[model samples]
Target: MAESKPKFLILGGLGFIGRNLVKHLIDQNAASKIRVADKAIPETAFLSDHFMQYIQHPSVERIQCNLSNPMQCTRAFKDDHFDYVVNLAAETKYGQDDTVYKQHIFDLAVNVGRNVEEHKPLKFIHVSTAQIYDADKKPAKETSKVKPWTKLALYHKQAEDELKKMSIPLIIIRPAIVYGPADTSGLTPRFICAAVYKHLGEKMKFLWSADLKMHTVHVRDVCGAILHLCLRGNPGEVYNLADKTDTDQGKINDFLGILFRIETGFVGSAMSTMAKLNMKSTVEGVNDKHCQPWSEMCKAASITNTPLSPFLPQELLYNTPLSVDGTKIEGTGFVYQHPMMTPVLVKEVVDGYILQGMFPQPKDYPRPTPIPPPSFETK
Candidate 1:
């Protein structure tokens, strides 16, 4: 028997992940209803044609309102009567302090929780990050201690636990260094810049202990997991979605050095920088500048002060050791299509971001050709 399609409400539908997933749902589940709502209307035409196509089915709707307001939530429920709510709404960066986070990051999580509890959403998939995992503890798993440092991590755990406690059907997916099309977040752009420098035979710089490990996943795979969970994930559970490759700063950094033919090492480590600065903050600062216009990138580089947070063996950002225990979600018959990194997939998403003029499109490098399979390492 064919299963009936569940109606969906993507609370932050116009954002990066939301827009991507909407594209997927449109391409595949032609009959399923999807409602996209975001407080900010998209400034770019990223979703116009796709949105128009999806809305013609008489099932899709778009709402622009403050979801944090209970009345708005109530009205949405009454108007749409959706069965699934996939929340991609979040303030996901690492460095932005508490200001932007509390107002939007934590706010959206809590609002979704309230709506799920009130509406008893058949399934609520919360997008989270693996950045919160204790990097000190290698092979971070679903059972690993969650000592979240950033405001974003704290809110993720709070949102996850609260939903579980309330007995709302929920799933938490912790992704590592999420990349792919439309990522203005800076990870992939740095990769591109390095490639450009290497391709041009310029010596690109590398920062951080190359031995330091990091895990990653493509954005589409995240959407795949959400769809899989919507169909089969158990309520009151958590899943860590990760790429099969156990990436480290060394492997990728060295690869970037080779590919871009540039120098790859901490400014101070093998080639020490001046006093009062660490490799990480310095390196991150240098790379983030690639996303900006030439004048802007240089101007910002001239004035930004060194961050005070010590590189004190923190599980904060450097550690990428992760194990994606999708056992529960897998038990529900979900297998990631791209279990490991595909440079091509990563390139595609980054290019999408560039086309949309999202931040982090470093002009240092032209986009590399799409990477083929065997990108993920099993180590």
Candidate 2:
């Protein structure tokens, strides 16, 4: 007799990470059937052309429903029996108020947790942010102290707590700033925009200390990690997903400056200090102005209408740097495809954005040739 194929359900499948996960599953032929539930339709979801084929594929099902609504979530899961259910739905905007975060992020997690508890899928994987950890320059472990320095992290921590209280077996993954192709959220697109604006000589100053650590994981690695956890991860265990390389804003700025061939200067500690003095009001004011051109560019490029906040709240920045120890996930026999955010990787992402019309490559921009991944050295 032939074995039955595994079925998977991805809530928030239209999101930056969720879309990539769906593509990864389909490309790997890992599932017999897949269901994608989200509040946005394919059009409004701002999915790239690469995803259109999968969305139209016979084995995939796209259901549009607000996961925040319990009745909708209930209906969405009523008749489906999934081997795996991955929850990527959450309010990820960085500048929102606590009330907004609690309602959209925390409440959504509770709703999904309750439904997962009821459905009892074979495995439940929840995507979390690295922001839960305090700003320590050292690599943070899953066992590290969780001092949420931002409202976004605070609410996500609350959501994690709510999920822990649920009866369903859960695998929690905390990922650093995720970037790569098809990335409209996080830092990728914003960096692209900054490069464009810088090339145009519109914005020339970096916001925070250039030395601030900027831990990151590629979206594909994130997908790979999620799959690894689903198959081999122990239930009720937490893993931090990040690369071994120690990347900081200074390194990123240098790369961007070289890539764009534009000389830029850091804003320095004095300005950052003032910004932190009145963090909320200052960030909101600056971000609102920045969002104007960003929104316009996104609209022109058909990308998702994501807000353009390059930095988190000032208080969060002043806290310890949010670096992490990804050895836990790596020890599970998973290797990062793009371990370090090298120049080649950054070029690939920028090229992807240019292809999508989100970024305009400068006429004189020197495009770096693609390089193969580095060979891992064993101790």
Candidate 3:
């Protein structure tokens, strides 16, 4: 007799990370069936052609429902029995008010946890963030002190606590800054744009300490880590997902400089201290010049509006180094295909924007071939 195929449920499947995970699973022939539930509709979500094609795959079931409402979540999961239930849904916008974070991050987790508990999936993987750790000069381990530096981080911590109280078999994953192809929200693409435009004409200057740690992981590795945990991770264990490299802002700038042949600099910490004291005027002045080109480029590409200023609010600038340790996940024999952010990866992201028509290519810039969709494997 042949074994039955595995069924998986992905909440918030239309999101950046969710969509990428779906693609990986399909490419690997890891699951026999996948059901994706999200509030987004493919027709109106402004998804790229690459993602649009996957959402329409025959083996995939797309469920259009909001996961925040308990009744909605119940309806979504009531009839389905899944081997793995991965929750990637959350309000991840960084600077929102406490109320918004509580409703979207905290409440959403509780609603999903309740449904998963009742349905009793084999494994429940909840996506969390590395921001829950306190800002320290050294790398943060799984057992490090968790003093949330932002309201966003605080709410994630609260959500993790809520998940623990539920009777579900849970594995929580804390991912550092996730960046790769099709990523718009992470800092990598933003920095690429900043370098491109700042070299073109704009004088958008910002200040940060050169040593500020900015740990990151590729989206592919993040998906791989989640899959490994779903199969072999110990219940109630937390793992920090990051790359092998200990990256800082200055190093990122240097990479961009080498790629685009542009020089990007930051004011020293002493000057940054004074600027923080008068952040309002400083931010506004920088935004005034920065927004002009960004707004123009966004309009050209038909992409949604992006805030003109690249400078984050002083409060959001939690400069405490975020050197996260990924030894636990690596100890499980999972290796990162893209261990460190490299020039090729950076080029792929920049070219992705161009392929999507989100940015204009330079006259002499050689466009790389578009990445083809992964072939579906038959077991």
**Candidate 1 deviant stretches above 4 angstroms:** 1-3, 45-59, 192-201, 254-328, 353-379
TM-scores for the candidates: 0.76, 0.87, 0.92
Tell me how candidate 1 scores on lDDT. 0.61
Q: Rate the local accuracy (lDDT) of all candidates.
A: 0.61, 0.76, 0.77
The per-prediction CA RMSD against the true structure, in angstroms, equals 7.4, 5.6, 2.7
Error of 3 at 56 (Å): 1.2
Q: Could you arrange the candidates by lDDT from highest to lowest?
A: 3, 2, 1
Q: Which residue pairs collide in model 2, if any?
A: 135-320, 135-321
The C-alpha stretches of model 3 lying farther than 4 A from their native spots are 1-3, 192-199, 202-205, 300-315, 362-366, 377-379
Q: Count the backbone clashes (under 3 Å) in each candidate.
A: 12, 2, 0
Q: Which candidate tops lDDT?
A: 3
Q: Tens-digit lDDT track for model 2 on 1-379?
A: 1126678899988888888888788777678888999898988665556666666666678898888888888766867798889999888776688788887789888998998888888889999889899678888899999998778889889999989998988999999888876665566644654655654566456567776787889999999988878878888989998986677777777777767777766677788778778777876776565556555555655766432334434444452576988888877898898888876677776775565555645546666344332122212
TM-score (C-alpha) between model 2 and the true structure: 0.87
Between 1 and 3, whose TM-score is larger? 3
Q: lDDT per residue, candidate 3, 316-357, as tens digits?
A: 554467779877888878888888888778778777767766
lDDT of 1 by residue, 259-290 (tens): 43468665445443331246466455654544
TM-score of 3: 0.92
